[model samples]
Target: MAQIAVDSSPKKKNFLRSPYMLTIALLPIILAAWWLATTVTKSVPAILLPTPESVWIAFPRVLGADGFGDQVLRTLTEIAGGFALGASVGFFLGVLLSSSSRLRAAYLPFLSALEAIPTVILAPIIIAWIGFGIEGKILQAAIACFYAVFITTLSGLGLAEPNAVALMKSLRASKWQTMVKLRIPTALPVIFGGLQLGATTAIIGAIVSEFIGATGGLGYLMLRYRSSFDTAAYWVIIFLFLVIGLVVYLTIWYIEKRFVFWRRIEVTRPDLEKQ
Candidate 1:
């Protein structure tokens, strides 16, 4: 007699599928699904749930007609400035703490505590103190970004194998030589991790601070749309934010590829298997 059996677990499939390509393919399907649902139900009004076409048409109008272009440009400028400042500070501190045990021990706890504090809550106080300008935004972004890089650098530096250190010492390598040749190279992966985290948070910090007080930005645009109950415009602003975040993320990813070529052999082995 044959026995019936069921396979309960899902099989793991190929990992070579590009998430980017999948997303692009799925976007139109999503829009179609949304359009059908709204049209069939008619439960929600068009004003409240404007179709994708409406959003597309309205998007360009915001460029000049409503000062959307200028707002976006200003916001991008602020984000770039803030991210640069944060990344610089984070990288420096990371290197410092990695090299100095005393500094890491003394400051790691403080850094952890600072990270626990809610950045959103700090926005009002920062605005009050710094008067709602670029300085406040820059400071906020820098602080948010600092700990990630610091910890990553610390861990990466620590990851230097003892044998490697011993070999360097036996070779009478100078402190600078040891650091440049061995410690720093071993820590590159961790440093890159910190950099990616810092870069993403920098964008978040700038946008959040702008939400608290600013006359420009995608965040500010979101605020205005919220006040007037223009959900469509709010959605558009949100989409723009997603795009900006993606851009920053890709930038960091590109940097990682440039710096961590050694990791690629391992990372892309799945592609080899698929092919």
Candidate 2:
């Protein structure tokens, strides 16, 4: 009897044998490390780095504390408001700048300088001027969001081939029509790249602003925990930040993938991946 043959011509082998399972496995490894240092080995002091169990216990108490819900609501509101305001202004400014060489040259340097300023310093002054309320926090997030979106939008629109624009002009397409029908769609992927950066930057801006002077917010909670030396509660706040940042990042990533379905996107650094 003839034996069956199998074709195993070279194809892309996954970097890991069991990608999903391996990813999940890392969680246990991290947890074990935390447990070993805090519990078994007792190498890390509890006050500085509380045990995982203590953090877990602190979560409910923190969530149930008075005004906790309001604090969370305020932070979320600031993020939403700031992101929307900044992204919109950035997009329009990008369009205007892209249309005018003189304007782009005149203002881009100033924008870049603003972007270079540290959020910690920028936030405090903005908070003071805007009066230590939600307005300042929103403005802080907006500034961070604006620069990322502005830079990306400008680059993305410019990515449109010169020949493509000439071809549109040959067909007697007006500038507005050319933009709507040709440029915007071409720029989506790159614009979304800006938005992905904006998402996290917005969060950073809001939190940093809250740190300057605020009666409520996750940052305020974190400050209170620090003052009291409540390591477990502080860890809980840290975890909340991690979760929020991850959610915002993942949300942008998902949207990017959804809209740019024609091309594949990778979350991992492209430099590390094999060609």
Candidate 3:
């Protein structure tokens, strides 16, 4: 019998497979490309695309010296208030509509039509009615968030397995009990999807409202900087907006991971088997 040779080389880890690692790895490449484009090649004008160093310098100054903290706080307040109002109303309305086919048929089309209209167009009208205050901003954010949440939630509720629902009914389960124990769990992932989309939309809405007319906020700051041709400062403000949007999305994602554990299990099980 021939002796078999045993290979004992350790498996190399693949960092690129990790999402966080991939993001980290891409940052330097992106920065280098931006720097090269602006500085070396001059493909983009410095006025429009400021140097990365200039933008980096502007970041700390904006945070400390330029009162950007107050602007960020104000914008966050508007987003929080708007998201709360919109999500609560959307969830309840979705539940009501899902409970009745006739109601869904009557209202869903109208809701879709309203969603089709750009929310930014309403910014001027909202500002006109409510003035350049936080109220109008909140309203704008809420309107932007509402439809996505409502439609997604309605669809999620409708996805409940009919056989499972029938089984629950045969066991004499109360409507509320069935909803709480079965329908809600089934719909959570989809509802969370809507919430995630709504979160980003709410931020956009707030910023657009600020752009139209606002006493303060990042959008107002961005407009000010742009008007003054301070491209570096404008980029800093844009970075802050990106950070805020990321924070909102990640917060929603964390909540989903905590509550929607079943979905996580379902997704991970296949990957685990492959491993």
The model with the greatest lDDT is: 3
Task: Please report how far candidate 3 places residue 2 from its true position, in Å.
Answer: 38
lDDT of 2 by residue, 1-275 (tens): 56422332244766666576787789999999999999899999999899999998999999999999999999999998999999999999988898889998899999898888988888768866878788889899998789889988998888777888999999999988888878877888999989988878999898988888897898988889889999999999888988998888888889887887644433233543354
RMSD of each: 8.4, 6.3, 6.2
How far off is residue 210 in model 3, in Å?
A: 0.7
Ranking by TM-score: 3, 2, 1
Candidates ranked by lDDT: 3, 2, 1
Kindly list the per-residue Cα lDDT of model 3 for residues 23-128, writing each as its tens digit.
Answer: 8988999999999999889999989899898898888777886576888889999998888888888888898898889998999899889988887799999988
User: Global CA lDDT of candidate 1, please?
Assistant: 0.77
Per-candidate clash tally = 0, 0, 0
Backbone clashes in model 2, listed as residue pairs: none
Model 1 residue 161 lDDT score: 84
TM-score against native, each model? 0.83, 0.87, 0.89
lDDT of each: 0.77, 0.86, 0.87
Question: Runs in model 1 with CA error above 4 Å?
Answer: 1-19, 44-50, 266-275
Candidate 1: tens digits of C-alpha lDDT, residues 55-86: 77767665545676787887787778777777
Query: For candidate 3, what's the RMSD?
Result: 6.2
Better of 1 and 2 by TM-score: 2
